[model samples]
Target: MTDRLPLFPLNLVLYPGLVLPLNVFEERYRRLVRDLLALPEGERRFGVVALRSGREVGELAGDPVDAVFPVGCVAEVATIRPHADGRFDVVATGATRFRLLAVDDSGPYLVGEVEAMAEPKGDDAEVMTLAVSRAFAEYQRKLTGAQGRGPVELPELPDDAVVLSYLVAAAMVLDLSDKQSLLVAEDGTVRLRAELSLLRRENALLEHIRALPAVELLRQGTAPN
Candidate 1:
């Protein structure tokens, strides 16, 4: 399961089973996209790791990944829209996660030596997935109300713990570090439990916002987000 991949370190974390729409406006990334498109469909992919600090390699950071976490998700390009100005708009889906063993800088983009991570599963994962899904349902309802809308019924969730956890985490409004921590978590149960806690906390905040006066809530800062 170990292999080398073209690395693109972003400020945001991408979880498996989620879609990430990227604007490859930079020349380096454009090149990366071009190279990927040149490959066969099965091999049109790259590694997207979150940047823990500083900028990504595209910005020519003093070090390509001085503050980056070693775990990342693999992104398979589903669609590519090329622009006349040499920019690219690509839609990719997260396939699986990997742990970085090391990095190489000999290519135009960062090359990561990585091993596919193991996915944990069991009764604990199933229970945690249910708990997190319940909390997320409440959270979504609260968020809808905060946005001046009626309640929204949460949709049926995935039965698999790994898929459910990643879906809930990706749809929630969380900071970079928190999401990154979830991404770096090796165990599915751990990720699900953490997400349950986060969903509860965020739902509480949303409930508080729902209790505020419309004008007051609007002025409260970021509009209940």
Candidate 2:
């Protein structure tokens, strides 16, 4: 059976085992925050879909929205602060993965009926967590050199395999599609491998860009010589 859940279409994708902080300022999303807060704790789950196309969430205006992938992660609000302007600052933690069924038009915000996807069990979880951590460390090293500084220090991750997986994935500079794929992955091993692949690709691209002659890059409108 499909269960209805509030939807938030974001330019970026969210992954399971990650915590995302969002500024809820738009009218519809603000309303979405309010509605979730008003619900009982168990029913406070919401779906996040990476918007593939279209500029605005509700104003598709006959333009095609890149079809939302069926798989997404459900998030539960972890922390919420109401702003003076009636907006919200919310930190949401991924809870479970879900597959979208249908989107309802009769709501202030988009609503979708989704089927929850079960997580995989076993020993590979630890292995995957380690892989993600290793890949992330390498990615960070490259990114720091490219940007000329390291990211701010983050909290230490838990020793538990599951929590570690989420923590590492959250810290990577993954784009929306990559994050979404991680969210829907059946197990930590799968997610970790995917993240590592993305990190490698990004590093390779950055190296390639860095190899170009400064003057040539400038001519291509990329950088100043």
Candidate 3:
């Protein structure tokens, strides 16, 4: 099914079951949030598309549509606090992913028609799940060593594969484009497989760096005149 919803172009990607805290100071977005809050609690939802290349507050100028990525996730308002200065602080939970169809430019803020993506399916799902989890652990261990941090327990994550995929992707310290790729991937297994490959690549790079001798930048201070 398709529905018209408000568009919020942001610098972050929201995965299903993930919680995002936002500060709404921009006039247009403040209006959008206020309107959504006025609706029934169950209907306080909006689309959060990654900003491909543009500012969120200032004029998008020519074509606002070009600034937003096609794929986005729906954010359901969990709790909202309106400030006396007309700003807002909100914590929203990601619900579902959607693809933007057509933009409606008449509103103060950008609005678009979107279709929700269907549930994902894949082969050897269990195998892929284990691969993602183990690879992530290896990567985390390597990353911790590089950061000079002591060993710590890995975060406990959801057992549900679907939510697990998102949690892992969200927790990863990766390039924005790489994270976007995982978000756009079709299903949990596909995302997990892709993440596993990425994690392995990162592990390799970290290992190579660890093998290199550390450079001592601070030379014994010779008495300088």
Would you list the clashing residue pairs of candidate 1?
none
**What are the per-residue Cα lDDT tens digits for candidate 1 across 11-45?**
77778878778878767677889999899988899
lDDT, residue 150, candidate 1: 69
The 0-to-1 C-alpha lDDT of every candidate, in the order given, reads: 0.77, 0.66, 0.77
State which candidate, 2 or 3, has the greater lDDT: 3
Ranking by TM-score: 3, 1, 2
By the TM-score metric, which is better: model 2 or model 3?
A: 3
In model 1, what is the error at residue 69, expressed in angstroms?
1.8
Clashes of each: 0, 0, 0
**lDDT at 213, model 3:** 35
Q: What are the runs in model 2 whose C-alpha is more than 4 Å off? A: 61-67, 121-129, 150-165, 204-225
TM-score of 1: 0.87
Per-residue error (Å), model 3, residue 100: 0.4
TM-scores of the candidates in the order shown: 0.87, 0.73, 0.88
lDDT of 2 by residue, 99-171 (tens): 8877885767778889887766345667766766666666655655566554645344465555555555556
Ranking by lDDT: 3, 1, 2
